[model samples]
Target chain A: MSRVQAIELVYLFCAVCFIVALKGLSSPRSARLGNIIGAVGMTVAVGATFATPGLHRIGLIVVALVIGTAVGVPAARAVKMTAVPQMVAAFNGVGGGAAALVSLAEFDRGHASFGTAAAVLFSTLVGAVSFTGSAITFAKLQELMTGRPIVLPRQREINAALAVTALALVVWGLSDRSVTAAVLLALVAGVLGVLFVLPVGGADVPVVISLLNSFTGLAVAATGAALRTTLLIVAGTLVGASGTLLTRMMSQAMGRPLSSTLFGALTATASAAAAGPDDGADRSVRTGTVDDVAVLLAYAHRVVVVPGYGLAVAQAQHTIRELADLLESRGVEVVYGIHPVAGRMPGHMNVLLAEANVPYEQLREMDDVNPQFPLTDVVLVVGANDVVNPAARDSPGSPIYGMPILNVDEAKAVVFLKRSMRPGFAGIDNALLYDPKTTMLFGDAKDTLTSLVSAVKTA
Target chain B: MTETTLGLFTIFVLSVFVGFEVISKVSSVLHTPLMSGANAIHGVILIGSIVILGTGHGAVQGVLGFVAVVLATVNAVGGFVVTDRMLEMFKGRARK
Candidate 1:
C-alpha cells in the first residue's frame, strides 16, 4: 500500500461521510446525527492530512491547533442564541481569510503554472472579499454599525469601477507572474467586499450573510483547485451550492429580488423616512394596556402568535410560552406563526422558541399559517413589525410593497406588542398598527409578556 | 484543461447537484442550522492551510501558513461545535 494511495482512500471516506452528514441534516429528527457525522468526517480528514509523508513542523501545527480550539470552542459554546447569526458571520469570515492566506502561501512557494496562477488568483480574490464582507456583516448584525443601508454618492459606479480594477489586476498578475500584483488584487477585492455589503439594510442582512457564506464556499473550492485536492473541491462546492440556494430562499420568503436587496438603498431609505408618524401625522393609531391585551387573548377561541427579531432582542420566548400555556389552559387554541425571514436570520424564531420548549408541532410556517388567519380569533404579534405589515399588500408606494408578509390583518382582531410607535427594521410604519380593530400594547417584550401571562392567569 | 483540472471540475459540478438535492428537502424551520452546518463544511479548507504550513519554506511563508492554519481551524471547530449545539436543541424539541 503506497502512501499516496492511502491518503486518497482516506479522502474518499471523508467525502462519503460528509455526503451522509448533509443527507441527515435535511430532517430535524436526524440533524444531531448529521452534526456528529460531519465532526467525525472533519477529524478524519485532518488526521489523514497529518499523516502525509514528508510533513514537518509538527510542533507548530499542534500549537496552532491548540490555540484555535481554545478560542473556537469557547466562542461557540458561550454565544447566546440571539447572536448566532453574527457568530456564524464571524466564523465564516475567518474561514475565508484562511483560504486567502493559504493561496498566498502557495503562491510564495513558486508554483506558478498559468493554470495554478489562475486558481490562486481566484481563491485570493473571493477569499479576501468574503472575509471583509462577512466581517462587515458581523458588525452590522452585532449592531456595532447602524443596520440602515449606508449609501454613498454614486455608490454603484464606484463599486463597478473597483470590481473592474480588481479583475484587471488579476489578469496582469497572471501574465506577469508577479506576487505583488496578486496581493494588490486581494487588497482591492477586500475593499470591494466592504463596499458591497455596506449599503444593505438590516432587514436584508440575513440574505447578505447567506450569500457571503456561499462566497466563502466558492473561495474554498478555488483553493481546492489550486491545491489539486478532490476532497476540498467536493466539500467546498457542496457548501457553495447549498448556501446559494438558502440565500435565494430567504429573499423569496421576503418577496424581494436578490438584485433589489443588494441595491435597494434608494427606496429603502426614502420609504423608511416616509413611513414614520412624523411624516404621516394625519394617520391615527390606537393604543391599549397590557390588561386589555390579556383579556383579548383570554377570550379568543384561536390565537396565532407571530414572533420576530424584537422578540429575540427582549429574550421573551419563555415568557411568551408561559402566556400561551395559560391561554391554552383556558380552552383557547394557540399556534405560532413563523416567518421564514424572521428575527435576524432564517429560522431564527424557531431556535428561540424551541429553546423555550415550545412544541414543534405548534410552530407553523408563514405559508401554512397565512390561510388560517381569517379563522383566527386574535392574532397576537409579539415584537414583530414588517412581517405583519399590511403595507406589503395594500400600499404601492411602500418600499416593502411587494414583499410577502403574515396576513395578520385578515384575523378578527389584531393586538401588537411593541416598544413604541416606531417602524420596523425596514424603517417603514406598519399600517396594521392603525387598523380599526388593532390594539397596541406597548413595553419591553419580556415585561409585557410577563404581565400578560399573569393577567391571563387571573382573568 | 488538463486531466486533473477536468477531474476537479467534474467533482465540482456533481457536488453542486448533490448539494441542491440534499438541501432542498430541508424544512424551513431548520434553515439556520442548515446554514451553520454548511458553514462548517467549507472549513475543509483547513486541510489546504495545514498542508501549506507543513511544507512552507521561508519565514514569511511560515507566518502566513501559521495564521491561515489558525483561522481555518477556528472556522472549522467553531462552526461544527455551534451547529451541533443548535441541532441538539432541535433534537430535544423533537423528542417531546
Candidate 2:
C-alpha cells in the first residue's frame, strides 16, 4: 500500500482498538486488558503520524512529547486514591486546551473554506470552554476553592449576555476567518465556561465534569471536520455521544434532572440548601460509645454497611472491611450498601473499596440494597450523609426532595460514623440524623472502625 | 481532500450510535473507570496536534503546534496511566 493508504489503515486500527477498549472496560473481567489495548493504539498512531511524508520539526515534536510524559506520568502516579476525581479533571482540562490550540493553529495557517472556517471556530470555542470548565472543576474538587455554589447577583443576566456575546463572536470569527477573531471568540467562551460551572452545587460536580468531557469531544470532532480527518471525527463523536449518555445516567441515579443540575442556578430554583444543615447543637442526639455500637453490630442478624465520600476521605475502607469480616465470622450476614453518589462520582466507592481488598460480590448497589434495608437488623453509615437523608423522599419542600436515597431509616437501628454533624457535599440538612433510632459515633472513620473491630471482638 | 462533507458527516453520525451501543449496559460499579478510560481514548487528539505541527511553517505556528503537542501528550499519557492505576485494583482479587 502507498504511504497515505498505510497511514489510514493504522488510523482504522486505532479506532477499532478504542471501541474494543470501551467494550472491555465496561465489564469487570477485562478492564485492564482494555486499557492496555488503548495504549497500544495510541503508541502506534503517534508513531505513524511521525512517519507521515512531509512532516516537519521532528526534533521539537519529540522534545514536546518527552516533556509532556515527564510532567504527566509523575502527577498521575503520586495522586492519592481519594484525589482521583480531581486528577481526572486535570487531564481532561489539558486535552481540551490541546484541542483548542490545534484548532487555533489550523486557523492561523490561513487555508480554510467557509464550511471549514465555521467548524474551526466551533472547535476553538467549545475547546476553550471545556478547558476552563475542567480547570474550575479541578479547583473545586481539590478544595482550592469553595465547593459550594457561588452565585453573583444578577448572575442569570450575565450568563445570558455572555452566551449571546459568544454566539456573535463565533459568527464574526467565521465571516472573516481571521485568527484574531477566533482568538477573541476563545477568550469570551473561556469566561462563559467559568460562570457556567461556578453555580453548580458540589454534589453535582461529577455530572458537570462528564458534560465538559463531552464538550472536549465535540471540539475535537469539529477539528476533524475542519481538517477533513475522518478518524478524528469518528473518535471524537464517539466520546461526545458516550460522555453525554454517561452524564445523563449519573444525574438520573441521583434522581435530579440534567437540565436542573446544569442550569438550576441560572434560574430561580437553585437549591436553598446551599446554606447547609441548620446548627443542631440544641437538638439532642443519642451519641454512643464503641462498646454499645460493637454490641449492637455483633447481636444484629444482618448488618448493611453504607459507605460515602467520608469513608474515602478518612482512608478507612480497609478498617471498615475488617469490621465487616469480624461480624461475618460470627455468622452475622454483612453487605455493603453503595449509594450511586456515595463517592465523588458514580462507581467511585467501588474503586475505593476494591483498593481495600473488599470482595466485589458484597458490594450492593442502591436499587438492590434499598429493598433489603427494611429486613436489615442494623445499617452502618460510614462517612456518608446526603444519600441517606430521608428528606430526599419525605420532605417535598426540601432542597433534595426529589433525589432518591438509601432507605436507611427502614432499618431497626442506624449507626453513623462521622467526624461532625456538618452537612454533606450538597449542603442539605438530613432529618435522619436526628431519628431516635439513630446513634452517632463522632470520630475519624479509621479510628472508629478500628475501635469497633476491637469492641466487637470483646462483645 | 476528495471526500465530501456529507461523507465525513455520515461517519460522525454512525460513530455516535456505535458509541451509545457499545457501553450502554455497563454496570454502575464500573462507571468511574469506564468514564476515565473513555477520557483517555479521546486523547487521540494527539494525532491531530501532530498533523497540525507538521503543517506549521513559521515560528508562531511552530510554538503553537509545540504547546498543543505537549498538552495533548499530557492528556493522552496522563489519562491512560491514571485509568490503568484505577483499574489495577479490580484485577486478581477484584471478583472475590
Query: On residues A113-173, what C-alpha lDDT tens digit does candidate 2 reach at each position?
Result: 8878888899999999999999999999988998877888788789789888888887888
| Whole-model lDDT values for every prediction | 0.85, 0.85
What is the per-residue lDDT of model 1 for residues A159-216, given as tens digits with 9 covering 90 to 100?
8899899989998989988889889988998998899899887767888888988889
Q: Which stretches of candidate 2 lie over 4 Å from their true place?
A: A269-274, A277-459
Q: Assess the local accuracy of residue A455 in candidate 1 as a C-alpha lDDT between 0 and 100.
A: 70
What's model 2's lDDT at A184?
A: 88
lDDT of 1 at A136: 93
Q: B23-93 in candidate 2: lDDT tens per residue?
A: 78654446677778878888888888988888688987888889999998998898899999988765543
- Model 1: which docking level applies? medium
